[model samples]
Target: MASSPLNEGLISFLATHAPNDAFAETDPVKASQTLFPSTTYTDAERAEISQWVITSSHVGSPSEDAAKSAERLSSLNTHLSSRTTVLGAKPSVADIALYQKLAPVVSNWSPEERTGEQGYHHIVRHVDFVQNSPLFGLKLADKVNIDVDNVIFKIKPIDAKAEKERKKKEKEAAAAASAAASGTATPTTLTGEPAPEGKKGKKEKAKGAAQAAGEAVASIATGKPTAAPEDAQTKKKEKKEKQPKPQKPAPVEKPLSPALIDLRVGHILKAERHPNADSLFVSTIACGDPAGTDNTSEYEGQVVRTVCSGLNGLVPLEEMQNRKIVAVCNLKPVTMRGIKSAAMVLAASPRVVEGEDSHKGPVELVNPPTDAKAGDRVYFEGWEGEPEAVLNPKKKIWESIQPGFTTTDSLEVGFDVEAVPQLSGEGADKKTGVGKLKTAAGLCTVTTLKGATVR
Candidate 1:
């Protein structure tokens, strides 16, 4: 059977994603379909594109607000998260149509904006896959510079059964909440406290006299009060005294070293300017915590933390792209510009000479070995030990040790024992050496700064 003539959007899509000898300049889509008939759709894949997801997506229309554009991009990101192409596993013309629309915008996205905290990760991944995959054979000169290894978030493979159940529960909860709000459905576990007025007193009644003192309930049951109150009081006091108090666990005393800082290799998935602060850039970073860890959240299946750093002006936003660096994960999470920052990214710059502005330019992130995976343990060479779970803010441990954090002439980060006297054991306990910051992969280094204090 003869197929219908290809639409204008499909013609343009073919020109970009799958251009070849099959395409006829006069009637490209029709000509391409005649030669490479695989472009044919069996009603399974829709052949539509011009009607943009957001009118602004096709071209950044001045009339469209930024919020709508963002909303559309977010929706597209989510849609592509599970599928390789717009038509699931199939390479359809729609994939190219999306690429044509999105390529320009993604090409311009700053690292902090794309993956910084899950902003447009799936979309970026989709674009990368469509552009490079052998199935597409798309040859575009102005391709987005994507480093697959420097991914912001590595989405874990989804468990079909678990996800299905989770979604089912979520839907049930939503429905229950809706019913309760409209005053239609009765109370449910999902609808926390919206029980019918008649059922309210049942909870108290079930407890009955048992909720009263056991002795009172016993006396009341028999309609007799012949127990001595003094005897009961003496027995209760005796039992209380005999029960041993829980022993307070002794505090874990770690040596005053960078090891207490809980440093680890972190990969910034995405970064963006903090909503509440101009000088702070908020980043979504993966540092290898298990799912549901405190102050940690899931992004693309990766357990990630929202980190706020003062690298907005000091470090170029473009450089913040999904890159590996050193991070202090055990520090107490703090709210920066209304965002809870779970980790601190370590960057280096020339030491501030007291009166100089510390927020000056040329800040470089501490570079972990390129082969180092996120969450790899990083510590000062000679100071290697099990790091504390979290640094105690009251101990001022981080503050005391930070002064000794310095970069050597060779660009390597190290802990100078002389800078922090507390770490320099004297006499028999004479511990003196510059411990370089490193992971099993290699030593961490900065770009140019040497003999500079690091924080």
Candidate 2:
């Protein structure tokens, strides 16, 4: 097929944009300096150049006359809209090539002002169409998209089954060829020697005669002949005594449990310093649904729950804000400083050299690398399950009676609310019935009389 005018125009545009430097001679560094001249081109100038390249390439041969070229460019713009799907599907190489050629033109179509109305509209429509199409139709790999200047270019996936079948056939063919070659190879005798050939002169004749005499004598004497060569006997013995083939070890089975997987990636929703403790801060972290949708009801499909710990003593308050960290999220709660603490943040302790001053012990708060984001799950070595919670010893709660009473208490009960009369005789006073317990005739009774005045 003949090369499209668009292709030719693109090539020309690239050549101009990436011009060779005459002053640099062969040095790329010096050539770049001379070619670029300035640090950057103004947006307006760049857009104008891009538009010219796009129109000229797509519109075909530019006439010597300015008016003719302009007319051709307008006609080409109209033709592209009517013919090409533009950005309806994924951006093709053609689209990218055209975009690169006309970068300046597209850039010039700023949100603030629109120039080259027809051309600009065509580019916008093309981009919109591409973005809205099925990602697979564009042949894009899973979770991967090509982005250029905030524009996404998608490609559909290749046929996996077809690819697998092609690979399987290739492998089978290779195996057959290998087997055929192996089958044609010569087989070794029991004695590890080549089979005897037909008689070839005196030495073979003498050997055959001796073997026949020996076999005849053995058959006549014992009805069993030992015609086999001495070496053959030795070879047979050696083969019999050969060690048995070794068997492959069975694969070790692993338990399939969440405790076996790691679920550390999540976002920090809220953080608060402990009121009574200077070295502790309570943080509420949300490990969003791993399946990508909030479907679980326990935590609104949140994979991880809140964890409270003493981070202020180890990490700076400012650094903790909006930061993602891998933490153990499934830990039993413990109490610290009369407050229930939940979950523990995973931070690497700094290595300290021997003989370091105990008072000035160097401790460093481990931070996740920049590539890691909030809600990114991490795994620990040898651990089988996902991290369900952070380790916080202070978040533990003990079983109690009376809402907060221990089993040792004689009166095992729950919270009892009672209303007391107000001084104004308008509202009732709220109080616990435990304080108003009365013991009479070996019986205990707790009662509350609403609106009753005790003066």
Instruction: Choose the strongest candidate by TM-score.
Output: 1
Q: For each candidate, what is the lDDT? A: 0.68, 0.38
RMSD of 1: 17.5
TM-score of 2: 0.25
TM-score of each: 0.49, 0.25
lDDT of 2 by residue, 112-175 (tens): 2222333333444343333333211232223212223343332232355866766664554344
**Model 2: residues with Cα > 4 Å off, grouped in runs:** 1-263, 289-304, 351-361, 369-373, 380-455
RMSD of each candidate?
17.5, 27.3
The positional error of residue 147 in candidate 2, measured at the CA in angstroms, is: 36
Task: For candidate 2, give the lDDT of residue 274.
Answer: 80
Mark the regions of model 1 whose C-alpha exceeds 4 Å error after superposition. Answer: 1-242, 425-431
Model 1, span 301-406: residue lDDT tens: 4557999999887888888987887999988988876788888999877787788887785777898987687778898877877878888899998899998888
